[model samples]
Target: MEETRVLLRNKDVANMVDVAVSMEHGGYVGLRNALLMDGAQVIETLRDSGLRGRGGAGFPTWMKIKFAYDAGGTSKVVVCNADEGEPGTSKDRILLSTDPHSIFEGMAIVGKAIGAGRGFIYLRAEYSYLFPILENALDSARKSGILGKNILGSDFSFDIEMRSGAGAYVCGEETALFESIEGKRGEPRTRPPYPGTYGLFGLPTVLNNVETLANIGPIFANGVDWFRSIGSENSPGTKLFTVTGNVHRRGVFEFPMGTNLKDIIYEVCGGIAGGKELLAVQTGGASGAIIRPSQIDIPLDIDHVASSGGRLGCGTIFVIDDSNCVLDIVKNTLEFFTNESCGKCIPCREGGVQLLKLIKKISEGRGSVIDIDTMMDLSNTMRETALCGLGHSTPVPVLTSIANFRDSYDRHLDKDPCSKCSPERGLK
Candidate 1:
């Protein structure tokens, strides 16, 4: 049987290509039937599917659910982390805006599997346009008996509310999100008690990314074998990539996990917005490492990207052309991390600022050999000492930039300026 192709736009053609048709075409009806029969069966199907988390770490989703289920709690909470603060990443917004119903259904299925009473969709404030759509979908699902008391006529009850994040990037982290939802300042907490054990007001909580939860409805509608057959053995199912930067057809695309990076850039996105040659592609957002064109032909799945010293961080692809300055871009990225650093930790709070200064100095032709050494030194310390992912991954782009674009920095040090940053010489 051929694999099913699902996209946000598929909902727009709901008259012809409905979710049922898509799931049936993809061999997912069995899972859906199993879910309707009993929630325990859905858990078994998910365990068989081997679906891991897609947000970043790629932890097993089933295990996360099992942990929450065994937490011995009556008031468990399900949270969908829609706060996508990663720069150059908009795929979550796309999913929320277009295929919200899928997410809603997924949340419902999860609430059933874990015996949860309430669920929350924590979306970023930037996605204000999607607020009405999500609210309307939840309201519609409730009225139609798809949500609210006794979802699908089962004893399981769930009510979903959409919560807007007030522009905090750290809130993307699960523990911080918990604090934010409680009307407290968003800051990551120390963990021995992971969210699965103790979260969301000291209750067992299962928090998943928007894209991760979006896959749930399809998983229930389709069987484990069907989902396993689509992607790689470890990273199964279709993953969404928000293709941006210099790409002609720059937008969100959903493809199987092992799709070629070259195809995503050249074939799917029409090759870098023009006839310009591809220099590097940012596989993730600011925290992602850059892959040179020589590495473009490599598969775009998590394991493959990791093998190539890159990550499928949120699957945000940025195609960089020769006209752009890698140094400037890296500096800007550092500046973002620096400005957005919640200042909760001394390492991230201070290190991000220091790295940005060095990058800016290099980009402005004011850096010396010592500056590069200083940047590397601080990056090493930050990587080791930082308290959160922000500090841990902050230096990824900086280090990758120096590795791939050493010559750019060298040229600036040699008192030669690139066309992009030659403004110090005042050229028109």
Candidate 2:
């Protein structure tokens, strides 16, 4: 019924000074104290909290742990999936920059839960700025006996190491992430042998997104009902959304899961810039579909977005104003996919470039009526034939654009003899 209490305050500012001060003043003391109790107690507290993965998937965090623990064996490992390469997304970056300790605490809790002696955070190399901050936090945690051998003076010893990724977008995939960490070329592996079953040097491993682990502290401090009460029946607790584009108040907003998109765009984000009419919204990053103006009233949550033909992916809300040409956006997004594709799959690597070529021709006024049909067919091929989710879900934006804004595409096809496409005409 009410909003969840803010656990990650002071995230916007680059004030690691305050974070360091907080950790020194017993910031993760609640979790450190909990490690004194049995590990099952911690898992029970997490289950009660009903915390779901903040990554696009929205899987339950506690259930992931239960699976890892039940798959009984030695050489169990825990990994923090900090490879946040999703375009139009920066929530995980903020978490790492402002509150790295929360992530560290969560990793330790996870290690304790699954009988893992070691944990590694597979972070992206782009944020080279935060490496020192993370190192400092780890050192501070170790000095206080919260991390390292005999954590909190108990036999349960847990330590976390930071490993920066090589900045490949495909590495964001769970299997690819494991492969990258193992010193292999960054590429995705086939599923069925899920990370829960066999991961990180052939052992049962648990991997969680940065924000999902960041919520672990509060789950222990507060009850599950308290967390569940903040959001809808299905999607509970607060989520961090990276709101950008031509908007008046463009930044991140932490709101309950089921908040209405219209309210967020108009009220929370201070409406579109210059009072421009809202064209559509890209709910997820590059991998998500676009929501037209007619669908603005939909709730902003995983199930709600999915039912409405969208995904509440990695929590990015890029508002598209009417003045911007839909074709131009398509070109920009296609170029991103073209460059980011790992070439492991033919459909994504080749098909993404081919899609860009078609869009480039259309944007330059050399497109045809048949190009539309060709684009649709290629999208279907990529979706069905691709090996991993990256290649499979890449066509969502273009397909959704065609479905919602067909007239825009039609305009490009039936253009009059004008400077809009003439050699003399300057690109808009």
Candidate 3:
């Protein structure tokens, strides 16, 4: 995996969170340059840069801004999704902890591009430790004339506030995050009136993940060609992967997009812990699929990982070792989704519960082949009928685990439990 440090360029810089230190290291240059150009030019530059949302969806950042720009609403808003809920994903936390000013700058740029005045950073409860740090950053920017009215002596005035989530994983979804920000139950709203057209108190809103927003400042500072030259044409720029679980050197790693998963695990992460043979690897989060060892060489991009039956969701790479049972992993993943389901849609709410039950049954040596078929059918139904991305993605782990490790599932179906079925294996 080739290292191209765009977002993490300042990772090693001391006192990066301080406004003075950040500015000294070429921090607000992007925003200052952006203020000189027309808003449309900023949008065009983002389009040419081939920047996509670092969130699980991987939607083009320019298209999203274009929708909000074309909507042309007066009461527009920008939202920064700091709710880093995806399992094994902590890159956003690192970014917010180290370089929060970059996200604020990005949000300000989005405000300038889309004609918005107010922005909100919907932070997750677990990451509340970063709240003071981010709040101080926002205060510093405001004190330095970069956040309040007439920023940088320009007529564009924008300010940002932080909102902490109530520990709801579903709220990580854009619409649900919006709902939570509105003081409503954290549930996904029906689409059609997407965020661009109608969002954030029924006004046009542009919401982006923390990492997605982090990319904006660099793109404006370095130009499109400089940004695009680092990664593949389809998926440009570096990606931050939170490589955890069973890896010797588990931490956040930044590499050019489309880098091979094998290199990420073996080279960047220093291979599996204790020299254990690599089993299956989960590329995304709990909602992501399990990639078998044979498919480890697939590029870690949105399209390529999807092509291999996984997603580059939040860039979380969970390295599973040979000692872990696939069935147990699936059970724990299902349990997470089951506990986190918002119960807004039947497919996710009921389907998650049923999937957990079936996985538990199989793990306890009480499952039949019929149960496996039923799980497949139920997963398909959930994927097709779920209300939001959360519901739709809930069954990915179950389906992928069964597909890649059918022998594990089949072994669980045996009349006698396998030796690995001990209570310590995480099965009740």
Give stretches of model 3 more than 4 Å off.
421-428
Candidate closest to the true structure, highest TM-score: 3
**Candidate 2 structure quality by residue, lDDT tens digits, 1-428:** 23243555646445443445656544676576567667677778777777889888888888888877878686688999898888878888888877777888788888888888889989888977877778887888788787889987888888888888888888888888889989998888877787777888778899999989888876655556777778787877888888889789887778888888888888888888997888888888877888688888988888999998888988899998987777777777777888888898889989998888887677677789799899999999999999888877778888988988888888887564323223332223
Q: Residue 248 in candidate 2 has what lDDT? A: 91
Ranking by TM-score: 3, 2, 1
Worst 10 contiguous positions by lDDT, candidate 2: 418-427
Q: Lowest-scoring 10 consecutive residues by lDDT in candidate 3?
A: 419-428
Report residue 132 deviation for candidate 3 (angstroms): 1.3
Which is better, 2 or 3, measured by TM-score?
A: 3
TM-score of 2: 0.91
Candidate 2 residue 237 Cα shift, in angstroms, is 0.7
Number of the predicted model whose lDDT against the real structure is largest: 3
| Candidate 1, run of 10 with poorest lDDT | 15-24
lDDT accuracy of residue 47 in candidate 1: 83
Candidate 1: where is the Cα deviation over 4 Å? 1-4, 7-9, 14-40, 416-418, 422-428
- Alpha carbon deviation, residue 61, candidate 2 (Å): 1.7
Query: What TM-scores do the predictions have?
Result: 0.91, 0.91, 0.97
Q: Quick one: ranking by lDDT, best first? A: 3, 2, 1
